[model samples]
Target chain A: MKKLNFGIISYAHPHALRYASTIAQSRRAKLCAISGDGANSDVAKGEAKKYGAKFYKNYEDLLKNKNVEAVYIAIETYRHKEVAIRAAEEGKHILLEKPIALTLEDADEVIKAAEKNDVKLMLPFNPRFTEPLIKAKGMIKAGEIGALEYIHAISENVKPPIFLQGLDMSWFLDINKSGGGGFMDTAPHGIDSLLWLTKSVPKKVFADIGAKIYGFPVDDIGTAVLEFKNGILAVLTAGWGNPKGYSYGLEIKYYLVGREGFLDVRTAYPDFTVYQDRAEKIYWDRPDVRGIVGSFVTAVLKDKDVPISGEDAKKNLAIILAAYESSRKGKVVHIDL
Target chain B: MKELKIGVVGCGNIFNLAHKPALKNIESIKVIACADIDGERAREGAKAFNAKAFQSLDEFLDLDFDVVEVLTPTYAHAEIAIKALKAGKHVIVEKPIALTTEEAEKMVQTAEKEELKLFVGHVRRFDKRWVQMKDVIRKRNILPMHIRKREVQNLPFPAHYWYWDENKSGGVALDLGVHVTDFLRWFFESEPLEVLGTGKAIKEEAKSNDTFDHFIMVVKFEGGKTGIAEVSWAYPYPSRYGVFYHHVDIIGKNGRIRYTPLDTPVVGVAKANFEMPRFSPLLSTFPDAFERELRHFFECIKKDIEPKVTAEDALIALEIAEKAKESARKGEVVRL
Candidate 1:
């Protein structure tokens, strides 16, 4: 298999390293070059060196590399727009992290730029590709659980020390930088899972949320009840409330109620759990990161649909954004998507 | 020790399983008399507990008793409770203090006027694990809790009990949702601000309307804390998993507590199809929740103290539940 070359945009985000590492591990995907933020260039350089990828001071310079066939937009939430648009415009296949952009308009720009450049865009919703959830998807489709009537998903984290490596408490707390609070940050995985399992978009969203934990400008805990097209209801809870050291060690768990059967996916404790002293490390077993990036490579190489599309990311983001709007307006906001 | 003679109205499953067993366990409380619309059921319950059997509510109310346990189908809760309260009898109506907010208020006012205790049977509060969970939540800065009450009655039940009635029993939301709704309020010690919900009625060959099999509700509490709950009676082929169960996850700023029946300590191997969790630790000894609740009820009556779940508390839960129905119907958020 001819390895498709991959490039990293920024290492400022937490999942940036995991995505870069996945590219490095893939048999069909090679980590080609990296672009680090101007302020945090050294961290990206170290990350590139550790992963055996060349570092580029300018993102555009990295995009100009013919070996960089695909770019993974692991930048901060706010810069998702500019970076994704530029990458898509460069005709490079894009695998962006969740929250494709800060706003729907920016998401639209990314979509348009990708279409104009005729590139496949994939969002690395890694958990969805986990072995258990893939089986769950097959169950729903195979009618093992019949029609999905309701789904309750939770993805909360206490921000393990590893997650806060180069970042501080205020880094993700700033609305200007992160766009939203705990729910927005932790909710994407659950939101995407609900969207994918049911294979339906939300019709309305009613979110009861607050910034109670950190008392920051953004909400730290919340639940968004999404009503999908066929009277299906899903409750998505994503927060930074569950402390790192807890009995229920994993921060992510999903439960689905269907007409024929029931399905539960504990993302944090997805596969297994282990205890070492006071810290209970939950190995929410997932496919190798390469499986996600490799899917992107396979999609680009075969001219097939990516595992996670920009449209799917847009819908999930819309559900979450509507949740925020509902929280602020104190009402159930209808989802046009 | 003075014994409080308790008269029971409406001979139902909860009366036989929950109250009778628990009240019988306590020494200070004696089951004196029982009444039901059906004379045979009343006779059956009264005989086992060494209590007298009355033919009707009026006859039962005419007798002397300190308290009355209204175990009728939920539709009759307010009516029976109001009559018992006006007669100067303490009321322990089963969960869902009343069918509507108005009835709940009337019951509350009547109890206040009569200077009698009105305890609503939100029995899950008595679960030692749940009590411990709430205590931990209070001591810790718990953020949000997700509760699920899934009854694997997925294959259409015969609708034998009044609970299957859409109009009177209030389906799964009011019947089951009320428990967690009250628990959430008790846990937060706050009033509800808003409620948004969505539910579905499973299609089956039945009378009137299909049983409301599924419901997902979210409630906003006063102190920025929130609760999300899903109550369902439908999840077909339940034996493929296990029996009915209640699960809860309490997420906090530092830690979390999860009670899942499926997360059993032991695992059981079955047919080649799959392996299922053997038995939930909580469900293994499920009667304790009701036993503790009944003990608390007896203690409150004897000590002349207010119960944890007051009529007002149940009223608030019902209020939120009612709004949830409205939210589901209106396809919009309903403020409490």
Candidate 2:
């Protein structure tokens, strides 16, 4: 199979570097171009150079490049809709970093642009790529853990100064740009993870959003209590200001208590540790651990739906947006999607 | 002197605490073999204790051993113990024998058929304070009892470790809650009639294998006796103090007893007239309790008297833990 040529439009998102590196190392994709604003373009250019790719000062220039068949948007949350629309218009496939957009309208705009252009749009919810998470989803689907009763999924980052800086990004801090703060920035991962693991969409959501810390204009902490279609209750808490020096961590715990027994899949981190309740030794050191970039490349090359598809990603965004709306209204919001 | 052959399965944090220390103390129990899917961890465990390591349970089970400690995660308790029992070896399993009542029944049945002694290590049952408390409860008609176990420290291991995995460790209820559950069931002498619980994970960026670090469970026993057990892995306190230190309250028909076992001693001189708060006497009953349980296991193997805390009993505790989790999830009363 021909290696698909790819371009990254922004290097400002902390995950941009990882996305770039992952694309560079992909067996099925080639790093072709990078585009970003003036201040970050230099760094993006340098990063692109390391990958032996061309760097463009503008999104149009990158899109015009004939070699770039697909564009991976790692820009600030606000730029997602505009850049994604432009990429889709140019007949390029897109792997958009999460949130899809700040609002339901903007998210729909991007989705529509992809539909209009007839291009595959992928939203990279990275947690779905982690082996433990994938295995947990499989187990739940296979009924290995029995019928799902409850899911408590949490992802907390050590609120280090560096991560706080990511939140401090003008666009990230602005509700108009970032949609909301930590809830919009990070909670989608948890939402997507729960939905994927349970294979159930939330029917109603009761959420509380506030600036527990960071003292930013937007909420840095939010909790969403979701009722899924299968009568499963899920609680997801996403926050910043966790002690730093730790990578982005996520835990998806499912309780499938039935007549026979219960099964638990405790994933400690993205990298290692898949624990069962009764096992003595934690299954650690997963060398073939799949991350989002690999999954994207494989999905595009294999013509398979990305483990977290654009639709799935949008549904998760709807849940987050609904959570925000519920928090704002101080009542339970029924999820339409 | 020939070393006592010992094989351990389940390479988790508990192995380091229970089996590791116990084996180091007993020169006779030579840890000859170890098994874990994490080959490196199994090797490290074997290296730490000077034993051979195997990545698969089959290979580990093939080895000749007088005793096998099933340290694998809690979900595998029934399968591993039953296999070890059928293999005709004395088995020591970690708490809450299985994830459900039926699984525990199968284990007991297998142990009975094989004529092997099965020891469920409710380690706190081996704690001195608990032993004293058990003695007290045995003698009195205790009413409402409260036991709180907290694990607030940043877990020494990642949340993805098997025990934190709901499938492996059965969440906080089966993993950590089971200890207090077993203690409560043994103390109350009755199966829980109903359970109510609630739990939430405070950390959002925690790993995928993690669950709610905070769990509060209220259990009502058959005879109008009720107990509450609250446990957490991310409670923001020191881990050792949370596990080793406990505040217990027993309200009886006649009198009430409040004790904080493993309390930090306060020593200071008063400038004028100051009264010292009375301190509970330092009780070093752990060694006795450990020796008693171990001797009982050995005796059960020889004399064939029913084990003190049978696998069936541990299963009952697990059933309570499961019901508590169900109640927590559903936010409704779970009738056991």
Candidate 3:
């Protein structure tokens, strides 16, 4: 089979940098077009040339490229729906980044557009693919614990002023664009994983979010509680002031307390730790994105069930949307479904 | 060797774990009496240290002791320490010295008039790491360190439960926050110029105190340098209490130094006892800090010299902590 040709939407997100390098080395996919609006186009021009692809200043031009079969939508999270809907309308397969949109209504618009045109929509939901969590999901299903009761997942980073200024795109802290602070940017790793591990849809959410230290317009620290349809209670936390690196302390921890027993996973440990004069960093085995990228490419190639689907993508964002609403309203917001 | 007969007041967790154990390490210091409002706890402490038990403070003060360890709650520190000092006893009280700046000031004045050696247990100053850190700071001038101290217990501590009363303990700000606040000031030897802070009583178990079990304070010193201390005790999830943790990092003009769990040199799979402050008191272990602090306190008494951590220094620490609490309560910067 001819390699499934892939085009990347933008170079805005940090993940896109990794994906651009990985997609070039992929056996099943060929990098075709790299396009977005912004100063990123100049960077994308060189990036596209290296991968034997063209750089389109406009994202729509990339979407119209006949040779590009699927698209990797790696733009700022708030701009997800607008680009995704256009990509879907062009009948392009999409592996959109987490937080498909700022609001569930916008998420719905992208979902309906994909259904109307028939395209595969996959969400990175990265932590779910980690070995420990995959095993935890199997254990929960095998009655290692009777049933899911509560999940506490947290993600923390040290984003001091110097750290934030270092990032080329600080859009993640922009309230209007990112919708919230680190909660909207980083919480999806745990939020999406919690929903996937428990296999439950969220019903209601209550949140306490704040900009405790940096005093950003939106919250850099927050904890949210989600009540799922299966009577599971989940506590989610994402913060940007951890006093160390992005994955400091326990990094991504999932504490699952079921009826019989509990299971805990801290992704940072058992990995090599390196220290600098000023700070330390952790070295872990990078995810075999073959499962994520290859599966999406293969599914698009064989016309089979995509590993992640359009509808499956919306569940996590619904909870995230409800959490933001709950925080704003100072009360639990019920999920529309 | 000039043997010091010590009387320990308030047979609390710190007394049983730190003071009694520390006194035992120094052969020159004999603990003569252990006192508490509750005779049972006092007896328990006395038996461990081979000292007499006294339920009355006056009766306990009559013991043949030359030194007193004011290990009681924050509210009683001023009275007990002052009485001990006025009676011509050299005193080595725990951190904060007293709850208020006024009370601490009086304690300092009384100790000065009596010409007695008075030290507050800012034990970190004795830790080899911090001692060496000070030497480094003297030469290089480390500035703007982010110091965080977190103590998480499995809860229901101080079987006597006096700590639950804000009037008695001043919650965490005066209780645990003082140690960090005191040490931050000690590093620079600079007076606290202003403080802006925030505290929370988010734990339902701590509701009776109506005060915070958590605090994050930013202190600005006279040299335009700053320090942020985040101290909390509200972690309840068993996994979070995996280990009692403390971290201090001083980023210097030339270099930096840090203390973290990674520095412990010992990590075993022992079962964690869900009790006061931590699964185990890491700082109290020999060669850590407590033993060093006690040795320093006794050596100062033998030489008839001022101890490294003096009552006046601790009084300044109390002043800073009170200002931080005020800042937190009023939502404004409290200028000293």
Candidate 4:
């Protein structure tokens, strides 16, 4: 049981901390090193010490480390391709944060780089690890609900990244860096879950994307209606449209209607509200992040295929890009992929 | 004190559930006669109101009624309303004034020529909750960025029922879609600029020449505002009667408001089922709104004022719905 030594590059994205914690707590993986953003090197150094991992000022330096077997790239979305290509060139298995890259061409090049280097590329979509949804997918496939007819999914956040406390996530509001605000950053998870559960491809998409609540340059709210090739119609509304008082950090809901029966799925089910003098917090009982990290580690260690491949994520990205195009042109755009 | 004698046509579900309950509370309006193609239903409805029953439209039109309530199927709305107007009677047709814009326009023209009142039942205008939502947006100067209204009806009718036929019911787009588009137009206070729609028939077995059982319509207003209207009649299985789910979510620059039945303080729990008791928090209590709408109609007739929901408003909603149907068929955006 050889433990995979993992290095995390750039703490710009908050999910980097969760990945670091999961690696440190896992039995078959170790947090070998961490690289910080140039402006926030001290915070990364503190985090590296907390996880008992070495720290590097530059992400390239962490990539150069001989002991690091795989790298979790959690930089800004704009730099995903560059760092992921570099990590692949370093002969390290890569677990890239979602969207794969900003555009389809960049995503294809990243996939090519991973294949050319013979390193595993995995995209961590935590919703794919949800237990009830996994069961629901099985039931749907098993003809428990009959043929699936329609799907209504909602993946909403209370506010944009800029409104996040303690950390400055304003890069998400910049169109150049994050591509789009809420739809780009928050919608991929639901899209990925839909792609994974249904195992179908979207043929056409009509979308309404705009900045509704917060007047950011990037769109904060978007809703896409997709018709899949399997005759399943899915309508997903994703973005920062929920109120600030919504305690659930990420509210993901799905309603699946079939010929015989229907299912209502809430990923954050079995959660409880804890009210205190400081703040009210909702604690979800599902340890989905740990599931994602553990499965990725096992896939790398056993030389097995990753649960969610880059190609699968690229398809999800295609649906998202098509949605943006549909919104811009005010027409139903056919997905080329 | 009954000043207006009302003759009702069509004794279907809507008549028994909405108009009947509403007409009960209006003291100024009297139901003098009832007409239906089915003699039994006509007799039953007439008995309920202690009014005379007529199996022929001509015989019913010959009666001395001041107002005609066209509660029949959507496709028959134009003919019945125009005939009622030509016979010197004010007409109050249910939502979706007609299946086509031309038919609706003819009805409007007939009303103008006859100098008779013609009201379209855009009942949400009188619903206290929706009216209050409009008030909040207006008084607070809230600019709505996106609004979503959804309606799901689990119709208990079999596959061969006329409601499933596009010719008679005008499908879900003209049937349920009109209610939402009209509400969105009223909420935004703007005309629809364009619409993109996608629809499908979830049930494999249904009688329809054309038209889907479910439709998702996106309307862009004159401003940058966006409205999403979703209507579904394709429930997998049927309940004893039926089931209805309606929800409204408004996202504005100033604030957000969500009105859903899940927030109701009332619930019904039986042996194996727990339900919201009411099909919709807005509609289950809609008898009050229906009463208000009827009272408004009576007041307009008495005071010589224009009705709140004019035939023009219903025409605009139908136009949007027709464009949505075209968009759904062509898989493209249809501009108004």
Question: What lDDT does the true structure give each of the candidates?
Answer: 0.75, 0.66, 0.70, 0.82
User: How much RMSD separates candidate 3 from the native structure?
Assistant: 7.9
Listing candidates in order, what is each one's chain A TM-score? 0.91, 0.86, 0.90, 0.95
Residue A158 Cα positional deviation in candidate 4, in Å, after optimal superposition: 2.3
Best by lDDT: 4
Query: Where is the poorest 10-residue window by lDDT in model 4 chain B?
Result: B264-273
True-contact fraction in model 2 equals 0.00
Off by over 4 Å in 1: A160-162, A167-170, A247-250, A268-277, A280-288, B139-157, B203-211, B237-242, B264-285
Give lDDT tens digits, candidate 3, residues A1-337. Answer: 5798899888777666667777888887888889965425566677888888888988999988998889998777778888999999888998998778877788889888887898888888777666667777888898765566666676655553444333356677677667778677777777778778767777766665556545567676666666577766666767664644433443666756554444556553345556675556544544635457877887888888876676776777777767777656545467865
Report the C-alpha lDDT of model 2 over A61-134, residue by residue, as the tens digit. Answer: 99999888888887877888888999999999899988888777888889899889987888877566665566
Give the CA lDDT, 0 to 100, for residue A70 in model 1. 91
In CAPRI terms, where does candidate 4 land?
Answer: acceptable
Here the TM-score of candidate 1's chain B is 0.88
Docking quality band of candidate 2, CAPRI definitions: incorrect
Q: Which candidate number would show the highest TM-score if scored against the true structure?
A: 4
List iRMS (one decimal) for every candidate: 5.0, 21.7, 10.6, 5.6
Tell me the lDDT of candidate 1: 0.75
Candidate 2 - chain A - TM? 0.86
Q: Judge candidate 3 at residue B139 and give its lDDT.
A: 72
Residue-wise lDDT of candidate 1 within B1-336, one digit each (tens)? 688889999887777766777778878778899999899999999998989999878889999888999998888988899899888799888888877888889888888888889998887777786788788777776644433333333433456656677667787788777877887777767788888788877535223356566777777777666777777666543344444466776654445667776663221112225544444321323676777877788788788887876777788888888888888788777888
Candidate 3 lDDT over residue span B211-326, tens digit each: 77656666766553445565555433343343444656553333345655433211111122332234344332234478888888888888887788777777777777788899
